[model samples]
Target: MKISTETRMGRNRRNPREERSSFLILCEGPTEKGYFTGMRSRRGPQLDVDIPKGDHISAVREAVSRVSAEYDAVWCVLDTELDKMLTASMLRAAQGSSVELGLSTPSFEFWLILHHAKYTKPFQSADDAKKMLKKISPFWSEGNTRFSDFADKVDSAYARAQQISPDGKNPMLNPSTSVWRLVASIQGRPEAIGRSTGAGRS
Candidate 1:
């Protein structure tokens, strides 16, 4: 039997109890928020992505405080380079809670960069990732329109991400990101997803 694209893509396959399941994504930056929002528009009506007004840790704390039954999943999309101490605190704060962390090492731009190519080199800073991205696309700083252009390539990016970390551990080790796992979850492939806790600085 041939499977439909929706079935192969894992869309609209939630269980009866999870029929009303929805997601709440707390983004650390506007770009992250816009990225998730673009995916939401293409995916369906089960997501609400927001960019809280604060630093990464504070925003994570804010997300933790707002977790309720209304949301079946709460995710915080953060860059691991924000601050070592703050990232540590954010991980601790999310422990035992429903808040899942989707971390990109060096920066979230690394995840975006993955859409264009497979990158394994470590970045010293988020700026480094941005610089490399600019080399691939001259108008890299254009904004959400740029992100939407590559949103459909998320699965390719996710596949490339898997090649970097086979054990699914320590994603903060420079050129790595757990963002693909979160993207998988958002795409309705929950089995391909993994939480971003215990991913420490390397």
Candidate 2:
């Protein structure tokens, strides 16, 4: 078969941006990883987040094992959307095999998103959610994002709502809430080091 110049030119088109992008390894929960990973596929194709399966020791270790080579920085994203959780997160991030780490969670609300009843509807991208939180929380200054503000806003918002979700499995609102933290470490909007964040997402 003969090929024309147009066909050759079409084939010549290069996805340089895709070729240049890098991937990242993170072990939080599935939802958070899914949200962040999903967002990256859209905005930062160069980056990817690995989600660890199950809570088994081996799985966690496996995630850590890959961190050394697959990713640029280590992150611990979770849905603390259940009962008061303060330590489980620290433990997961510690297994980072000595890689540097960043962690985030919603307030007593568990996760950072607004949907709880269905866990699917009203789902927004990670970047969009981060911007939402900044708008809601005063501890945050819109452009400036922080996990602490996330916790506070979550906690305070939960108090005002006067209701608790029965979802025992994925307590947190998914890691989309922490995208800003992930972005800040590399390519991101200018932000403060560590302050309370905004209310996050509508």
Candidate 3:
């Protein structure tokens, strides 16, 4: 995909000759691909969201290898429960590479649940998170969930995620996710952390 060199609206507004940061988002599943593909930024970095064929590790490795000078950041969106061994291997491989991880523990549904309310309880598996998520969003279907349903609540979710995990580390921890950190980066609002609504319930 070609990178957009045109300046965006807010902080990214600069002379036409100025360069914009390009981003590559590699997702683990169709749901992640669909969600991130809808993300738009008027002033933030340009993004290319993709879901490559193969396991998460191999996909991530492929994505990392594709990160050339044309892209400034390459983010891999993964679910911790999909493949623990592969996830670990991918993390190890990302050590020296430019690839960054946006991981969700148990499943990516945990991140989506945060959009509605705070849920700190540890989920047994991705299915567990999905079951709980259906309670809040009856329309949610794995790999079919739409981004438009919760796009407006992204900030709320991000704040709740920070409240639950301030440092944004350790995806092995139940109910922990660093997806918000990536969203904040895409939005160019690193300082937008810690603003919570306190509406989340256990």
**lDDT winner:** 3
Write candidate 2's Cα lDDT for 91-195 as tens digits. 454542544333333431223443222123232344444455445433534233334434434334333222332212222443313433344444433542342
Return the lDDT, model 2, position 15. Answer: 74
Clashing residue pairs for model 3: 118-200
Q: Which one wins by TM-score: 1 or 3?
A: 3
Best by TM-score: 3
Preferred candidate (lDDT higher): 1 or 3: 3
lDDT tens readout by residue for model 1, 1-202: 8889977668756665455457888987767876777775533547888888878778778888989988877888888784567667768777767687877787888888888899988788888888897897676663544457786787888888767865446746778888776776667676645543432321
Q: Weakest 10 consecutive residues, lDDT, candidate 3?
A: 193-202
User: What order do candidates take by lDDT, descending?
Assistant: 3, 1, 2
List TM-scores for all candidates, in order.
0.80, 0.40, 0.81
- Residue-wise C-alpha lDDT for candidate 3, range 42-103, written one tens digit per residue: 65567798888888678777877887987766788888784567557767767667677787
